[model samples]
Target: MKKYLLIFLSLGVFLNACKKSDDDLTPDKGLTPDSEEVMVQDFMWKAMNFWYYWQADVPNLSDTKFPDTVEGVEAYTAFLASESDPGVFFDDQLLFSEDRFSFYSDDYKELTQAFAGISKSNGLEYGLVKFSDSDDVFGYVRYIIPNSDASTKDIARGELFTGVDGQTLNVSNYIDLLFGDNDTYTLNMADIADNQVTPNDKEVTLTKMEGLVENPVFLSETFEIGGEKIGYLVYNGFTNEFDEELNNVFGDFKSSGVTNLILDLRYNPGGSVNSARLLASMIYGTHTDELFLRQRWNSKIQSELSDSQLTDYFADKTNDGSDINTLNLSKVYIIATNASASASELVLNGLAPYVDVVHIGETTRGKNEFSLTMVDDFEGSYVYNPERENQINPDNQWAIQPLVGRNENADGFSDYTTGLVPDIMLEEDLENLGSWGDLNEPLLARAIQEITGVTGKRGFEVKMPLLEMTNSKMFTILKDNMVLDKKLDINIQ
Candidate 1:
């Protein structure tokens, strides 16, 4: 009787173990947060693993052990359980409404004070902390305290301090404050509303193209050549509209006696890659091997567009006369600055093989890929986060993406981290410019020099440049004029 009881008990334990194993392999429905947690953990693990897989062949984050790295499958499982959720300890009171939150809210404030004290005690620069309302919580966390040790370097974000009591107080910003262009105060914008942040007096001037569609192509002989005409075409922004504009511009440039082309992307914050490709084709006369620009992400967040899968994306583009295999190339001088990014970088990479591309001004902001659109559960709106994208080059390897793929030049040699150094570097003349304009216009002058071989003056000053139409003006005018004058006809007999 004892032997039979033991055998039954053993069988029961075996069955329970088998059921647990089966549960592990089962497909998860969206019924529990476990599924969400698993998805995020899986992505983070894959991201780390991808780094390890490529590290043997690429230049990347050193294989040095991270403080976060864990051992054993169970340990790995436990670590992810803690780290996956960013909103784990969200303060319901401090969310949404601005009035409930304060600079002295919680431990964050005390943490900042402690960090400030440390800075002053060491006689180091008290890193400035600026504060403004922010759309993203994590974004605020990242931009300010990018890492754990960030407080030691700059002013602490919100505040997270050590538990050591009565540590000497370092002088720091009471709250992150926005002050006029001052070196002493690091700008804090974690609290400003999107609309409120936009400067009412801010000026944006557009030239070359005139229409609702933001495709601008302009011609100018303002830049001179030696007894010959050098035409200048400056288009700063890149968009789908710009793509359509490029088709027309390239078609015109081929026919017109336009020997030199200048693309002014100095102030462009970046837009669409389709436009970047279009611009690349116009400059690079032929197709080249894949170019790496940036990374894309596959986040756990649900995007409206995610519902439309990649298979559908390819199919839809086919109907719209887009075949991914083909590209155009033409000779162009792409003007760049530090502000240029993402698709703008794509333009540079795509055109590198075809033209004597000269990147002027400063190094570009190296965001190379489109972000995944994540709908916030609380806000019910879209937010963007970077993603990893694969771009196989002529060497059949990943392109220059920091922390992921290999960084390489067009020659297939990896080293594009500080970004593609300009063929000719020029410093912006801040005294002569109101904003980041074509202060040096080095690319423009170079394009002229390329065609005419004449060295022109260094910087052309524009003191009272035209103020662009404001949103209010545009809106008010539209409201008053129900029918556009161009669209209406007065044909009353």
Candidate 2:
């Protein structure tokens, strides 16, 4: 029940002010709305009108599209009945063509749980890469969640799978084969060579369970190499609930007298803005007085908000008020990939103005626009409020995570839509995706090389470039998002 800065899409909040500033967001709930779809459509339109970042740009979402009266309600009833499915209307009609990350869900319960890192998963977080020159795809294990069905099976990271059940995986059947309605599936293992993939004798069966909570902190260890105490953390997501646990990892890093840190955000897709801020605070010094990030909503919101209300500052403690462990380093080495997005990108961008961020991986997933979580709670201006959950229309379990703002660092730079380019270019080698946290791993090896000026210790060669087609986490809501959180509680104009 974490409260988010009411937004939509995959954008994160840049609310500088987490203060509560209520506005008169009372929308016409459609006095004589046609049907259930009309009701949901009415809610969607109103939410977008007030909070959507491109509301001004989307002609359909224009403030003048409908008057703020009973006639507007009648228009909503009449116009919405033309479309049968709310999801279709949301996608085809309401969303902007340029919008890449905005999304709507039928079930707010599942969506919120996803933001909390809870979902029905086999525990295998994998990425699908197309074979050298064929449409045929091979899946490689990224990481596994503790106590997941995959965790119990005989599977490990860097393992390759060419098929599901008995069918060979390809560009078309993979959706139904892997993420389809079937609860249980067997992964047909494979062996990789010079661009050739061959099926092996091993098969691992995994079943999806209810409410699998994954800890974003995959691994945290300090390495003593070349007279430098370096910390390596493989953080998968920015799940807010696990913020305390993530903070504790830094606490351990702090105690170990680690001067250098290698933040492995190669698998992270993003989570809470607060969590990202906290992580930034941990890496950089917690200067509550200094700015961390800022927000730029639609012009209407921009006009309504004061300068301070649009900016967020670095915090000295967690949301729970525990003192944050700060490294206060001048430079940090970051491990990124195409999967690194949203809040993951935020940490690097936000810290760039302060700390020297050495990005060492593929180009990141470009999702800078921050979104908010909104239910059908119109009285609260479409903002999802935990205290007002019961008040939310029970008939409307639908929720919209819309792009409401662009999150910029203190210097007002959020233009990474194409993606944040890396300082060092390196892609994951599929032929030898070495063990996680091991120094011999390609990404880590490069980071260590940069740290201690040791190059020849670990082989740095790209046997075969991993051309990623898709991934497991990308299918989830975690992919390509920088959604909203408490920062701007400004009084809506």
Candidate 3:
């Protein structure tokens, strides 16, 4: 089956800097757009224009047209003015609210094109595609790209995308074309049903494994290659609670006989910056304080890590007789992929200075921006509701919040916006995911080769559908045997 995962853009402080106050008695009108308010308003207008053009169902626009400077603005303005039948006027007082919703015709087109690419890439069977406008609080249209012919289209679908003006775009379709379609089918799942491949009989064929044990605490699962010790562990998400869980996971690894580690952050989409610091503390040892994740705000120089609550995170560096400064590993292999993003990239890039790092996978999604804390003025109570919001409130008067105080990396580096590239880059055979586990694909194969000095057979490239339809027999099994296992204890009363 083909899965359609949605691509999301996080709101940076810069994103929310445009909360204009109509209530202001003295509003400065500058011809040469200078202040943050202008940028924000311009951003919203441009975003609207993007929707207008996309919905025209015309050809895909060039990426170069993205507004970058004052000159670009003149060009866009001229384009709009040149249109004889300007459907939407340049000076049209367009107000974006949470109530109305629509989709950029082009966004849907892009989604269609992406789906076609994914279908061809994964060799999946296409089903009927449907699109509809969303009735969500935030304005957006939902598009459902199904994998099978029978899947139903529900208004209640998936994620929402909001423009800079707080106008949200609902998924007209339930499938996030990037992940998998609801009704798509993959050759592997099809083959498994047809009895083409059998399970790996629990035969532990993987033998040789080597890597530095930076976070000595992650040795919970023992690999046979190390001759009987839980040397390495791999987890997906770094949730808010992961801070404490990570310490325990790492601490347990050290005492359990894990001398090395290989952190596999292939599909981690990122969560919890504090958890990221907590992860850093394990390998950073004592000097973890020095490694900065970066500063937010326009005047980054004014920010410092000590100013935030995430400070002294590794405050108790002394664990048993071993401190962060004293703990050392031989080598660290960070397994990555095109999907490894945000917090995942943070760990990979943050620990680069002190470790012998090896990255294996496609280029990572570049993202840098922590959620800001927002204090909204509740009506006229003079009470600012303090809450940690993803971006700044539309109202400029509200305060911006951040977890990391500093504006740089732990290595004293700056400008960490585009994300980091790995030292040893390895492309995975995309087609192989059908026959093997997600991490057991070519990327991992290459990482293992680099770490263990083994030159195994090259992996075959096979494209599988992003999503597939498993019958109720399989679906019931998944819900009962898989999803539930992670939560409730089945044996409990």
Candidate 4:
């Protein structure tokens, strides 16, 4: 049965690739070189018209405005070709004022790799915290990858850096010093004294690598407290490739007879929808046939899609055919921050109807919409070839991840534009930092207190009033396609 299933999957992929290749073939129209460019422009417009969630807001994409006739196609294509850059021209048509997730990428290869949890990095994820009443900034290491150069150099989480390559970190040079194009640089460590961070004498040299696979499962453990087995999972990203690892963690939780779950998504930026659905299934347990999420596309496509095709249901197994280790719990605790978005929000929203979700920490990032990547095939069309497993356009090197749908749960509740409010709003205790997976950690501690009905002593207080300041600069590094994601594939093929 498993062998037959594998064959069926392979055949499906083959048929989809063949269909995409046939779709890419353009009609033989005797036209000039400029007209060829116009055809590509038309391709972009049509793709957006059929799939974009905000298609109604885009006046240029309306079928009545740009019909599929020779006159309409010629006029629209000529206008699009007049722009200096077609990519920029495509961006102008999107509803940027309200839709911030839609983005254009010059290289689809890089974007596709990013979706698979692979990227160029020194294996450091940090947040820049600026001291109040001063221009000095400190880089706080969040986590490091296991095989990265930074990990080899003995860089640990919660370690602060005051300078880069001996240059002081100020507002002006912070961006360049941290995000500069240097292959190797020295990090001047900082010392925390009297609730303040200052430059220390220690320095560590680090080198950046080309491809690093980001391990999304940071930590997972089952704890015994008051005869109840509590499972803790610090999941950072929703990358689909890591679904097997995620399921394995859940398998351990099931084996230990976990009664409650604490899902840590404080630093997670969302990824794939398939992984999110699998996770929802693992948590809810009995909701396999229930609606997990519904994607409401633009009016044109919405009318064409059946009810079943537009919605995603909970599944008993992961994408790999392995049985999911479900908890079957009535309540669960989720730790979130402003960084939690997309699939993160999807899990929180989708499970609300069935479970008593006790959301801790800060408000969510408030992105209720999802995006689909559209790449150019260089043959004046957007192809959805399954042969391109990662769905990357190797030819033109151009792609657009546009907001293709707004997601809703079984209750049809999708009004979280601002953000989902936390049940208990407590700031992250960075002043008295505790290691992750430690039950004494502030966020995890509070969750344990709620579970066991026990109030433990709090961490030592520090006199850092300025640490409460919201650092907008911390989120600057995440302003890319990495932040935007989808609930499912919108490709018709």
Mark the regions of model 3 whose C-alpha exceeds 4 Å error after superposition. 1-220, 226-230, 294-296, 300-327, 373-375, 378-407, 434-441, 457-493
Residue pairs that clash (backbone atoms under 3 angstroms), model 4: none
Go through the candidates in order and give each one's C-alpha lDDT: 0.33, 0.83, 0.36, 0.71
Ranking by TM-score: 2, 4, 3, 1
Which candidate would rank higher by lDDT, 1 or 2?
A: 2
Off by over 4 Å in 2: 1-37, 67-78, 487-493
Q: lDDT (0-100) at residue 168 of candidate 4? A: 87
How well does each candidate superpose onto the true structure, as a TM-score? 0.42, 0.92, 0.45, 0.83
lDDT of 4 by residue, 1-493 (tens): 1222221122223223333343422222222233655544554665676567777777776657755567765676666776757567777754446887777666666766777778777887777777776897777777887789888987787788889998988888877777777778888998786776778799989887888888899999889997778999999888878898999998899888898999999878777777888888889884668898877767655664557556888888777789888888789999987777778888999999999999998888788887666665322224333345444334456667777778899999988979889998766655555688988877888898889987787742434422432232233223322222223333333
Residues 1-493, model 2: lDDT tens digits:
2343433311122232234445422333424464565888878877887778888888887767766678876776777776779889889878988899899999988888888889888889999987667788889998888999998899998899999999999999999999899999999999888777889999999999989989989999899998999999999888888889988999999999999999999988998888899999999988999999988878757776667767789889887889999899999999999889999999999999998999999999998988778898755667776667787899889999899888899888999988999999999988888898888888999999999987664567798888888899878755667756654343422
Q: Looking at model 1, how many pairs of residues clash? A: 38
Best by lDDT: 2
- Displacement of residue 166 (Cα, Å) in model 1 is 35
The better-scoring model by lDDT among 1 and 3 is 3
lDDT of 3 at 51: 23
Against the correct fold, how does model 3 do in TM-score? 0.45
Each candidate: RMSD: 20.6, 4.1, 17.1, 5.2
List the lowest-lDDT window of 10 residues for candidate 2.
8-17
TM-score of model number 4: 0.83
Whole-model lDDT, model 2 = 0.83
